[model samples]
Target: MTKFIIALAYKLETSIKYKRFKEFTYNLLENNSYPYKKHFDTAMIFLVLSTIGILIFEVNHKNLRILNDYELFAVIIFVIEYIGRLWISSDMHKIILDDYEKYQLLNKKYKITKSIKKIISKKVDFILSPMAIVDLLAILPYYRPLRLLRILLIFRLFKILRYANSLKEFLQVFKERKFELFTLGLLYITVVFFSSTVIFLYEGPEGVNPNIVDFFDAVYWSIITISTVGYGDVTPITIEGKLVTLVLVVSSFLVIAFGTSIITTGLSDRMEIIKENRVQSETSKMQDFVIVCGFGMMGRYFCEELLSIGKKFIIIDNDKEIVNSAKSLNYLAIHSDATNMQTLEMMGINKGANSVVALTNDDAVNLSIVLSARAINENIKIISRVNNGNSRKKFDIAGVNQTIIFNDVAAFVASEYLGQPVAFEAIDGILLNKDFDVIIDEVEILDNSKILGKDINLVDFKNYNLTLLGIINLSNMNNFIFNPTNINYTVQKDDILIIIGFKASISQLKSDLINLDFRV
Candidate 1:
């Protein structure tokens, strides 16, 4: 039953829709695996059920006497949760593993327990602190009627949500735009205070309710008029008050509009800075990275594949705004034309990079980049994207290791629509290289082989799915024999066979055909 309850709790935490809720539950579970998450989950269930039971009791007031016992039960459950937190906190020595480091090598039992204590002790305060206060408040019912405030106990849910990315973004916006928001808030306060004070002084003597005759009323009126939400409960009846109201209303509108424009502009600039920082930071940390010349649809897919394999790369585009947008996601991007020699240098082409993938939409620009990169580092591999078949030959000669023809791919896709699966297969075979597997192996003839004098065909090839394409005879000083017929093929000691087949079948065939006597 305990195990079942634990499974249900794990599912609830992991499967929660709210990112904040999920993060909260995950942290709680990770931090205090022994009992913290279980205790919290149990406590919450009890609180929710008790609150609902109380509400039902309130609805049927005549039967409130019957439900009187639940109030104490609810309080007891909360107190137990609170005590459990304290007890778990006190067991700090058991949870921490670091204390073991302080002991001498021979004292294994002492060190282990000490480490456990240290880990638990360090985290105890974090688990018990604000949450304990919330737990305490949740169960304290001052009055049966005032039990509605117990609903505010649900605000504890905010603690979990506060760690969410959305909340972090919200907090970050305020942190980044602190001065601007602070200035706006100050102005709003001043407008409210002054307008309310004037109206209070002006409207007080005219028999308008003195209790509502303060600066707050005038401030309320100002907000309503400025926002155009005029609730109409309060009004400036006196001539002096009316004059003040007129000035306040017009000035308030102007201030609001001006403030909004300033704030919006400030936020946009901050966001841009954030994006640029993201890109620079992301790129600066990458090593042996591929520098992609564009971030178009094809370039994006290429980047995604590199990222999937955990390979590092950076993007370069001509648009500053586009580059900055990529930066905000913490992706490395440079805003520059790929064809420029200076742009290539700036991307560290001369050092610290393995390859460059030119993906510009412009064919001529991509060709120029390939030529420029080859001149900079002839050893650097260049993959150039070509839009048409006409440019493939020229790009290949310009030292482009691979040239992708976008049009050819598009033609194949179009052929698929026309019901040509063979064309699709051919396209896939060319692009993905799916037809055959290339295996490079150094095979040495063993003394136990049966076909020492016999031709190569005497060795069974069909059973192993093997095809011997060539041989390198070390005895004749590393001469390569390509497609040698069975009569010419003679098994010699230390002969290396280069073969191709399906990868698995090739492994089995190699094992059957050759055995290494010794490996250096």
Candidate 2:
């Protein structure tokens, strides 16, 4: 029978359908991004909470037939989840097949007993896990014959931790420092017991400290005194009792101080881990996201603009202080090497990263950033800040989509003010959206547009109070038709129009274009 079972296990191990079934089951239980996992979690949460609430309600109220039926349904669901988790917890077939393969390579007869032990070992490990233990206890209350098990219904609350990530992170801090906490717990227990024994022997109803009636009273007094909550109802009247109380109070302060230090330090480190994990998780779900490779002045301003436009973005910076500052403002910022190809990939380059801006103030870093981003996603747009003029060639060769030379732009702006101050101010005001009520925006021509194939001069830009700056040809973005006034430039699908107008006018024009409502 064991040989036949081993043969069956080996067959299942090579089965694609079996492997897929196991993978899907595991993902349903574990993967946060798995599609039905959310609904499963939500349903389990409702059922768990419902069962717990029903128990609490029945404490004072009578148990109705409807409530019992709901409770039974919830228990059945709990059992299903438990069995599913167990089934996916370990691959018994793989375990048996592995040892069999090892034995086959050795030219020895495979002992199915060894595989059985290994299979049992893994299943036992998972069953004994903390969360698994909680899951087991959660089911205990459903055993109607065991009335005592009903009190374990409170364990249902801990089951929610499986569905909640934040709680897991919060609890993990203590789990990491469990040894220190365990030591502290031992110390406290020893002190409390010793102090309670001393007080009970010295100050009791039979002794001078009469307020302490029994051993229970002595324990109460010891705890209250250690905790610094002396209510004066149970005072240590005797000299020996008072001295013991003094020492206990001092010990309490030390215990409190050490405990706080450990917890505080642990929490600080844990919070950093949690934040990084959160950043990664948030980045994974992002599509067509802009990755800002610095948290400097330019990067901050760019992030602000992106946020204002409701565009999704991820911030990467090597400077921890700058990253923290960004995080303080609730920005999704990660402290990482922007030049690292792995970091770019982690920031969703291989996924749907729309663009990457290398805004670090270093030319070399920005160049490396461009190269790394290009390597990860060749089609992704790479925008870089060129601090040095000589590095422009390197950036160009690295396939940077756009390069911004701050010094050159600033110098040109200064020169432009001298040549065309009024025009400069008007354009700057519209760009800034501060000195004027107008803004510059782009409108893309789609296939269904009413103005498609219409000449530039035919479209009345004055109706929308928009200044037609230029049209970027769909065939080539570099081909911009400047001052396209009364020319035979026909509008076509996918052509982008750069127009300066009010926010409302730009939105209205976009809406009109979408609805094909280009009416005077």
Please tell me which predicted candidate would have the highest lDDT against the true structure: 2
| Structural similarity to truth (TM-score) of each candidate | 0.41, 0.83
Q: What tens digits encode model 1's per-residue C-alpha lDDT throughout 1-520?
A: 4345334434544553744643454556333322255466555565555666666557657646546666566667557655545544433322332233334355754434344455565566655566555555565543446746656545444434222323434456666677877888888778777877777877865467553566566667778876767777877777887888788878778778877787677667566545544454445445699989988889878987677546788788887877766667666787778788877765667766789999978899899999999998999989989997898999988999988999898887887858977877765574456344544444566666545555776666565666677888878978998866445688787776676556677666556554532111
Candidate 1 Cα misplacement greater than 4 A, ranges: 1-148, 206-216, 258-520
Error of 1 at 471 (Å): 12
How many residue pairs of model 1 clash at the backbone? 12
Question: Where does the lowest 10-residue lDDT sum fall in candidate 1?
Answer: 91-100
TM-score between model 2 and native: 0.83
* Candidate 2 residue-wise lDDT, 419-467, digit = tens: 9999998777667765466777888988888788888676677898888
Determine which window of 10 residues in candidate 2 has minimal summed lDDT. 429-438
Give candidate 1's root-mean-square deviation (CA, Å).
15.7
